[model samples]
Target: LWWCPTGLLTLLPLHAAGYPDPADTPAGRTVLDRVVSSYTPTLRALARARKADAPATADRRLLAVSLPEPPPGGVALSPLPGARAEAAFFERAMPGSHTLRVGDAATHATVTADLRTHAYAHFACHGSQDVNDPSTGALYLWDKPLTVLDVAELDLAHAELAYLSACHTAVGGATLPDEAIHLAAALQLAGYRHVIATLWTVGDRTAVDVATSVYTSLVDGAGLDLADTAHVLHRTVRALRDADPRDPTRWAPYIHSGA
Candidate 1:
């Protein structure tokens, strides 16, 4: 598991914090080079969050949200043109899932209510991380933001996985990293078994590719085992890393948490 140090340590990659390669081979070159890493806000939270295992594939139901436009009075966030594409990809990739896209159709009330019934969820939109109070962090919905505090108030007993294709959903406060105050952790606290989140602002197009690869692997039985999601992510990220080894920013920001 990974835990980034709060405060000045945010610049470091705690998950990839090891030393030189082992003499034997390339296995231990770095913490990231070998490990199938996962992140958590705190050790206790991690333990609590793993109380339940991910549900079976047959039982999975997805709720996908994609907001390409910034809300009224909110500055343009470089329109995530890929958001619609991501949603459509999932609808076809994971057939029989519910999708709430840009329009008068997806609202804060509808999205939150849908959370309780769905086993999995995906969000492709702009995200805001509240530096002073990480708990106030949120992912933009059609009408408003689904704040971390708001997520914590829900009881999602059937929730199995959540993929936040937005920015900084996994980032915690620089002062209190162990407090588990961000949106990803808040979803865990609300009973989600697994969450895939970003550590910082990520490339919009890259985010879509990662999400596509992940869901496709999870649904296509011929691909990697969905039961071993960490391994699935490891392979996916490694492929992305191999494509452009120089840009760690693209692949490194996405991390899986929980079982």
Candidate 2:
């Protein structure tokens, strides 16, 4: 399912809408158990992503950016101690195909520069959504925040997946509810074929678990394939839901956007 929600509907998790009664059969329980869901800012954006050329297998590179500790002299942001572990997991999982930019190394400048060369990016840090002005929403880095406007301005040809294991990366602006202006949408506009993001605040430990499960299913002898992202995410989320059916907030917040 490709959702193109407008106005306040953009803020809702349409993909996760369904009854979760234990008595119901698996297929009838929730949307998570049914079809794979993806969101698009518009139909045109979906078309553009579909038209994008797939990067060569040999050219596939992963950029893992983690900020476990906040840099000094900045607006205080909570430390994501699990981010370092997440990046390290990626390094071990992808081996030579991954680059680690942890702590002081994960600056806005370096991340943007690395995004150009990498086919995939995994940001394990703090994300802030400016509800009043979504374009100002950003992923907090070492030197500064990588805002929605910054990502929207990029034109990456080889971009594939951007796994934003940060909080509220998909929340749209309250002032312009119909605009679909958020970090996830901005990344799609920037030429990433797919993006994995969160609609609300997520626990650091849960982020690690979700990333680990998703990547474990994605990586194989043939390597990661962007085409299977939605399906893999669907399965991972289903497993999470099954583990804790009472807390929809834990599993339902994670969403896939783009092709």
RMSD of each: 3.5, 1.6
Question: What lDDT does the true structure give each of the candidates?
Answer: 0.74, 0.88
lDDT of 1 by residue, 1-259 (tens): 5553456565345554556444466645566776778776556667766677655554567788887666665556667877888888866665555545564456899889888777878898889896677777898777778998899899877677888999998877757543467888888778876788887889988988898888777874312234767777777887886687567788778878776
Looking at model 2, residue 223 earns an lDDT score of: 52
- Give the per-residue lDDT digits (tens) of candidate 2, residues 1-259: 9999888888898899987665444455577767889999889989999899988887588899998997667688888889988988977888888889998998889999999998889999999987887888899988889999899889999898899999999999775552689999999988999999999999999999999989998886435776789888888888888788888889999999988
For residue 57, model 1's alpha carbon misses the true position, in angstroms, by: 7.9
Which runs in model 1 stand beyond 4 Å of their true positions?
A: 1-12, 17-28, 53-59, 177-179, 220-226
Mark the regions of model 2 whose C-alpha exceeds 4 Å error after superposition: 22-27, 176-178, 221-223
lDDT of predicted model 1: 0.74
Instruction: Provide TM-scores for the models.
Output: 0.86, 0.95
Q: What is the lDDT of residue 28 in candidate 1?
A: 56
Candidate that scores best on lDDT: 2
